[model samples]
Target: MATAAIARPQVSDAEWEARQELAACYRVFAMLGWDEMIYNHITVKVPGEDNAFLINPYGLHFSEVCASNLVKIDIDGNKLTDNPYPVNPAGFTQHSVFHRHLPDAHCVMHTHTTAGMAVSALEGGLQPINFYACNFIGQVAYHDFEGVTVRAEEGERLIANLGDKRAMFLRNHGILVMGKTLPQAFLMHWGLQRACEIQMATLSMGQPVHVPEDVVAVHQRDLSKVQIPGGPGKADFDAMVRLVDRIDTSWRN
Candidate 1:
């Protein structure tokens, strides 16, 4: 329950840009059918504070999310802004633990996508069955289902479960991806969830797998390029924001 400082400086230009990117990530998650109404959340650390972040207001659907609609709150789940909307304590509990403990994790994105849940429930979590699957090699963590992550007591457990990892599979639930920037988190979540979907689709075929450890390791190294700043996936975030604008400009309103 770390609280943000009361007299912090105003949002810097870079942070303002991040807020817009994070909002677009939420909308793109919705567009990709990864959102569970307004139940899930994507949070980003506000500039200049290790314990402060911007999260979507609890009542708004992802489609209704706009940059201005995002709420600023402390890692302890306290709202710092003057928005009339109430923060979801349950979602805050889930997000705060990660932000409080992981200093490098600027953006934490979670979703209850069907494919993600399916993969989480499988006997093997994120088996190396596809090229995309290797992107998570030696990096993913798994947290047992704690019955919805609504209580403050769950925070410590969740943080420990996610220790030093960039991706987490909440068993019988969904996925979480942490990144240094909103765009990076969005890209990782995209790959993580899509990898799960690919695994599910391949399993449905019920045939022998083709993954080799050497091959997976190689692909994993190559895919690391996408995670680099200024890579194609990095550019995708800006493009996706424009895509959202094309589909529904009101998200900016």
Candidate 2:
């Protein structure tokens, strides 16, 4: 698929902004070594259209995704724009279901990072032993894996298992996170990933100390609706986007 910049006015400013942010997200994941080749997906619903979303071209690496080349598709995976690139079947199947069912799921991210996969494979799942783990003590949900997630039936189960939770682990597979905003989702995954990495490291050595539930409850209560000191907010996302531009502003295309 060509990465050539899409001509302007073909899309609304809101849609274009969504493209740039989604593209920047891909690059940020690439920089963090969280991408699984060209397999995993980060999807964002187009701001101006209902049930319409954008995904990376199936054959393109995260680094290769640009605002213009990102494929625009509807909830049913039908291409809404003319493009040489195709959308990944698995990505579409899962992402569409989430978008259709959850209003807050404006941005859905699925990844197969080593730590994310490792945590998913573990029977214990993500434990509340690390600072990052505290953000999702009782917040994480789990789903039983049903082969590759290309089938629509599997999507129903995925959403059912997801319930109202923002983060989910596809047991024996990987991590899935949703957010009302990209910053929230990205921060959730970052915290989850760091938790898993720390858990794996500490478990290899011996029994790890767990954070108290009372403390987590308190934090969860206090953390809602307010931007804590180190919390991932819009500011953090803006900083990361700047970093992506420094590396390569092609994402802005």
**TM-scores of all models?**
0.89, 0.94
lDDT of 2 by residue, 93-212 (tens): 999999988988999999998888998999879888887788898999999888998999888788888887989999989999999888878888888888889988989999989889
Alpha-carbon deviation at 196 in model 2, angstroms: 1.0
Best by lDDT: 2
User: In model 1, where do residues sit more than 4 Å from their true spots?
Assistant: 1-12, 225-232
Model 1 TM: 0.89
lDDT (Cα) of model 1: 0.79
RMSD of 1: 4.9
Model 1 Cα lDDT, one tens digit per residue, 183-233: 778878888888899999998999748678888778867765645558536
lDDT of 2 at 80: 89
